[model samples]
Target chain A: MYWEKDIETIPREKLEALQLARLKESVAKASSSVFYGDLFRKIGLDPNDITTLEDVRKIPFTTKDDLRDHWPYGFLAVPKDDLVRMHSSSGTTGRATVIFHTLNDINEWTNIVARSMYMTGMRRSDVFQNIMTYGLFTGGLGFHYGAEKVGALIIPAGSGNSKRQIQLMQDFGTTAIHIIPSYALHLSSVFEEMGVDPKSDTQLAIAFLGAEPHSEKTREKIEQFYGLKAYNSYGLSEMDGPGVAFECPYQNGMHVWEDNFILEVVDPDTLEPVADGDGGELVMTTLLREGMPILRYRTKDLTRIIPGPCECGRTHRRIERIKGRTDDMLILKGVNIFPIQIEKKLMDIPGVGTNFLIVLEREGFNDLMIVKVEVQKEFFSGDLKQLEGLRRRIVEDLKSDILITPKVELVEPGTLPKSEGKAVRVIDNREE
Target chain B: MIAYQLSIFAEDKPGRLAKVTGILKKGKINLRAITISTSDTFGVINVLVDDPEGARSILEEAGLTVSMKEVIAVVIEDRPGGLDRLVQLLLENGINVGNAYGFVLESRKKAVFVVDVGDQLEKTQRVLKEASLETLDAKALSAIEPFHYMNY
Candidate 1:
């Protein structure tokens, strides 16, 4: 019943052997790329350098900056004609990062996602409706081809038009869906607006949620709203899209297909490997990709390798959900917030006091930023409406600047705790 | 002249309101009327005290953010539409009431409505005086206890 079950549950040593062999091959392939060729030539290195998995750290990290600086086809290891398909980031953050795939790479990626879907109970009898955006986004076409490979009845219903989406579900007896978490919530609300109860009205039973990092609470909310089991799939455009890691039936942690990628959890600050189960940055090396054999790519996604065996018996090591991304700035839900961003925004407002405390809390699968702003004495009045208006203005101002809606609490001056050392600015309470 | 109330900025938490009252009690300040205006995170405790200047310094020295704010006190009818008449008059004059509270001085004839008229304090006083509405200054308010006439 398992897709490449032997490889999935292969003994640790055999998997390591396979990884080592493939890693060497991947390195040889990557050296053909302009970026890696230049890097290897300058360092006087060869594919034989990665004899052991530990030797991976010896290789320089391929960062997003390295990818962007090189631009369009710099990371492509094969000939330009070999690439049949590509997926890209929206470039909303900055310049877009594009991943090229050869036909064989497409087959390989399709096979893994097929395997991922199969492992989660998708079969030929199921009607799979892709409810994500198509074109450029890997999530859409990734699952489309994977579900096709599974021999499922496919409806390429690519995103939005919520009413038609629900109609397609009821009309076709759709049993499976690949959707984004936030959109899932939005569709669920539409279902309520139409007075259509998903639990009884639709034939849907399974759902796959991905694209953005969401909370367990958010998943549970969707599950309750739909009366269906929702799964979280993790991937990035840099890693050739959405089938990189997936939650098994147990729903404990995601089994990162160890056969296809080597996983490394390193402390973000020290850049040293953390002990197993310790929270750190997730660095990945693609072993099977041919067009782009990215080695020791610093994903910047913070998660830990789940310690101990999963009940599903897949030998591939599991990884916790992404905690957050670390850069010189903070990437909260893919949006970068700088240390001075809040203070800078506050400076523009007339009545904001000098002292402010930023508290980051996890609110139901979301990062909640509560800015406890010390109310300026001149602004403080016994008038409730005026104070509330100030709070709303502060919220709107910060939202425009940082793109995160923060709850601005009007606190009295001298109430916030004093620090003896460097000024304490932020308090992050998000779980690792 | 505009009367004053000791406005203490307070955080909304257990025992925070107690701390403000404790300082006022220890300083032996008698309150004429008290009203707490709150937002999500904080509240302002506004008390028309027998001694506003004394209470402000006491609270300030106790590490509290305290201010003696201007409030206009007017004696109105202690009846159902007593507040409505005064409010309608102020609304017609374009005087916004930022904060307000009241207490009775007589059974049905006289009750004092204390209001923080913000920037329009002087204008509100002139409007009320022209309307022949009697207002209690700091001296008149602190001098009388309404319950002193009732012994039950």
Candidate 2:
């Protein structure tokens, strides 16, 4: 019933033993790269010295800047001819972190993603429609290969074209779909516009929602709208994307595949491991990747390990849904807030549309946060008092939720910018 | 008395008004009367048009938030006291005009005052009738040719 059952349900001690051996092999592979090789030799560290998982801390943490400083091929442990494919970040901030995968790495990644899909109850008979972008973004190809490996008829529906996506769902008896959570909400409106009730009209039984951090409420909203169970899939391009962790049928927390990744939750400031079940920055060490194995790469994603064994009979430990990226945290008026918190609060309020923008600006020396929310079309009926009341209520609600009174601006529906890729929720124009 | 008016929510920025008018012009929908209500950062434009449903759909398709609202249109004298009298009559009763605009049909002789009383449509029409105001229905409102004199 399980994919790679022996490894997936291995005893705790056996799993640790497997992880340590793989971790040492991965460290050796990572040390072959110029970046890690130079750093390890300079720091007087040897890959052979890492006898225990705790010894992983002895190796310096690899930062995104280090990757950027090394640029194009500094992290490649194999020869250029051995590399099969590469995926990259958007690189809006600086140099993009491009991860290369060898044929073996690709095979391993595909297997993990296939295992993840199977865990979510997708079978070979299922026709999977992947609605995430396919280019340099790992979400598309990662899920693409996995669904193919699962022997499902894959529709490489690479995002955006809501009408075409709906048409595909109807035309191809699409049983499963992989989409971002926000887009799933947006697509529901399109389905409404097309006069098709997704619940009754299509054969969508399973939805794999990821590529962005979304709350349980968002997942519940998508489930209610689309009439399908949406399992959360988590990964970043630094590690092979979209299948690093996935929710099983239980749908509680995503089981981090311990056989492939050595996961750690660390205090972002001190770089010390946080106690189990406590929130901190998630650090991952690649155990099976050969092309570009990274040791203790800080994902910048903040989440906690779910302390108990999954009821799904999988022995791999689970991690809570990502709270927010450590970099995406906004500090205003001495209060630290994540955009997801604002999204959760705004989404709960009636008449607030699915899209919003949190704009941070500086007026003189003080920081100002202005939340521009889209008022639903039905609610934008020029009722001056009612509109004012909604604005006031939003301001009050946000103030109570985030502990900072923000200027709430209600715009017409669909006024905020909609991104086909990952939605840019925050725009900070404050001068540092 | 189901006169339709296209109420559009707009941001108060340069060229925004031009953008709305440009869309209507391109769509071949004629605007009969238009009024803008502004706040600090945004405004709402209520336009009386010959084809309100057509205009609303086109505007909405063009990414503008347009809502078709039913309003009351009344013919009144174009003299200075014409609007004052109508406002006085509505106020004498408890009816509040949520939005109002006027266009002169013939200077000093006749004009049309379009008023939006929100959900209190029946009460406002009753008050207007009691005051002996000549209100135009949707047919008459759409048939109005501004500044073209026609003997009654």
Candidate 3:
């Protein structure tokens, strides 16, 4: 019944041995890259030195800054001709982190993604509709290839156009969809606007939600709205997106593929591994990647390992859904949001003032981020509808840039609080 | 043009209109006619005043968004068909009235309609003149003493 039954159900002892073998190969492959080669030589390290899983700790943690330091080709383990594709972060904050894949790497990623979909109970008979953005972003193509691999009827419906998306679902009788949890929540309103209850109107049975951290309450809300079982999927571009881990039918926690990568939870400050079942930073290493192999890469995502074996019978360890980031990055509605990114968007608009605040609150089970900006005195002289048009334009621009629609509240100039030192741009009221 | 109207950007909140009228009162600007066009959150207040420029500058100085717009003052009989006749003529001529307000100048014989024809101010005046309708410009509008009823 499993996609790779033997590999998936391998005993703990056998799994560890497989991981160790693949780990050594990955280290050797990574050493061929300029950045890792220099680091390995400086430490006088050898791939053969890592005989057991514990020896992986000897490798220094690779941070986002290191990725930035060696942009474009510094992490290339293979020749340029061997590379088949690449995916990258939006780089709204700084330099975008990019990941390259060889043809084999793509096939492996596709297989893992397919396995993930299969674990969620998606079948070849199902029509899978993928709603993530394609090109440069991994979520789109990652799920696209995986669903295709499962022999499902694939509809590569990119993000937005809510009406058309609904039409396609109704016309094709789509049985499955892959989308961000927040967008799924947002689409419920569109369904309501069209007088269609997703629960009774379409043939949706399963939803794969990822690309952002969401609470269990949000998952339940999305499931209730869409009338489908919502599965949590997790991945990062560095390790290949959306298939690093997935929820099985049991839905207790996400099963991280042990055959592909070594997962670790470590204290962010100490750089020491935390005991299993304790929350800390997620660090990962690629075992099967060919184009580029990352060792001990700190994901900066905070999650804990669910200490027990999953009921799904897969030997893969399960990681709890991500809690928060170690950095100031806010994942609002499944899109990475930085206060500075909002600042940049506001500064680009002519009538917007310098002082702005991002207020995040929870409306029902979904998170709502409202960007309150001051309108210049001169701009306030327009007709009431003109001001409204300006507000809508700002909202549209910000949504296009960040992929999450934010409510733009235009306030009078000098109304928002000013600061002398570093500005406090984000006021999170979600906890309240 | 004999009549000028001040269009002030206003938010739909209690005391917002008071704030605008308060500023005009402080400036001693007499309000001849006023109409508020509102949506959900914000609105526009179109006001015919004795001194349009003075009202605009003072309202702007008080931090209210204010602009001066030209409008035509039409004098019609204060009877049942007076407004209908004027509106029908504008409709037939394809002239859109962007903003309009009216005030009765006498008990039954006279009323003044302040119409902001937007960019069609000249064409609207021409249409009114050809139709033998009496129209007033800024000078005649500012000189009107409406409260004191006189025989037409």
Candidate 4:
């Protein structure tokens, strides 16, 4: 059932041959791609000359902004009719970056995901519950397809509604759960509320958690509560989502699908590839993508690449868990909320007086984001004691609604500063 | 009948009360009775709120780092030594009070004492009544207005 042995075991020679073969094919494909053809011509390099993996670095790197500049379908190597699936990122504004996948691309992605699940000790008899959001986000469907690809029954559970998810775990003998680690902790608390010890629950052997950066402390908590080993799944919307690399039973670093993905750890500022085992920004080149092929896409995720063979016996190069994103996507509590979440939370609530300033401050050890909200005149008419009581009430309500604890200060209506551009919703004082 | 009392563990800090109260305020929950007893590193804030479940969830959501323990709430007269009489009665009955605090009810002529004991709650209630002391149901404390008396 195994594929080629040399490519999977003897890494150096196999990588060299794979690179030469893929480079020749990619160069020919690049010569035909409109965007890459102009890019190669502008750079004064003949794509045919780049035959080996060593020479592949001669090609330029692609970035998020580059994809944004091209917009809808500029990066696609194939026509719209051939594109079978489209996924998007949850960008700051409504406009999201789109990715297209062909039938071949889908099959390749499914293979890698299936390989990842199998490595994590998943079996065909296992019931996989994918708890990530589906929609434009790749977390849900990506995991679901991978589980089904391995002949496992999949429950497209999505995220939130912890009450229902726990109940489903009882109804269906869910053996594997895929969701963010923080949400798993939230589920642990819900498990306690239902009077069922999570540790003694229906067959949850392994959990695949991703979509945000997490600490080892958090991982220990999730493992202890669920009574199952927690594996970290790493990927970005720029890449092919959460199946990019995954922790096998060994729990070393994640085994990158090196046969399909050409990875380089580069210094962000220098743009030069760093030495192996050193931390740097990850830049990837898809060897087999058809709908949208990137030469060298800068993922901007900070982590080191371990070139050594993993204990799981996979020769695939591995990357350590992601520490943080290059951009300012802050994950607070268990929610993947942006600074915009604050504005949305404030605007959604009525009778919460205006002139608010969202200040991010670190209190003791905990990072706190306090909202200085104005107290309306109607709120004052209530009992002074009750008004003070109401103040606490509003803070509690906002915390539950947004899933982030925000300290509410009742300020005067005209105190906060007005903004011209995108409202400076976040006043970040936490040290950069 | 019965009175519900809750004991919450808290780390010692300047604004700890403000934080706990802040969570209660946000939940739109009302505390009927509250007492804070301090030790070296941590303090226990005993509270009787209108909705125990709602209050517990709010406190946990706010990340106060607290735990809940049940205590007995007994009704005593608003007069001085009213609690002393009960304490003497409990002592004669071989009952020990680990912690004790009381909150006055303005609408009634009674004050409720939240007492932590090593003995059984039912046995303690019967012992207090045998000594002619009135025992209140756990819900009685939730109906009283929470007076914000700052210790600072």
Best by lDDT: 3
**Lowest summed-lDDT stretch of 10 residues in model 4 chain B?**
B143-152
Tens digits of per-residue lDDT, candidate 2, A1-432, equal: 697889889998999999999988888888899988998999999989999978988988988778879878998899999998988765222345788999999999999999999998898999999998787778889999999999999999898799999999999999999987657877887898999999999999999988766678878888998899999978888889889999999999999999999999999999899998999999998999999988889989899999988888999999999886777657453234667677877888888887899998765434689999887877677655666778888998888766668988878788788844566489978533
The alpha-carbon deviation from the true structure for residue A315 of candidate 4, after best TM-score superposition, in angstroms, is: 0.8
| Best of the candidates, TM-score | 3
Question: Which TM-score value belongs to model 2?
Answer: 0.60
Order the candidate numbers by TM-score, best to worst: 3, 1, 4, 2
Query: Candidate 2: where are CA atoms >4 Å away?
Result: A91-94, A329-432, B1-152
Question: What's the TM-score of each model vs. the native?
Answer: 0.67, 0.60, 0.74, 0.62
Worst 10 residues of 2 chain A by lDDT: A88-97
lDDT of 1 at B63: 77
Candidate order by DockQ, decreasing, is 1, 2, 3, 4
Q: Which candidate's DockQ is highest?
A: 1
**Alpha-carbon local distance difference test for all models:** 0.83, 0.84, 0.85, 0.72
- Please, what are the lDDT tens digits per residue for candidate 3 over residues B30-99? 8888888876456678888888888888987787666676679898889999999999999999999866
lDDT of 3 at A2: 90
lDDT of 4 at B16: 73
Chain A TM-score, structure 2: 0.78
Candidate 1 clashing pairs, residues 3+ apart or interchain:
A215-A365
Between candidates 2 and 3, the one scoring higher on DockQ is 2
- Tens-place lDDT per residue, model 4, A329-359, is 5655323445555666666666566557778
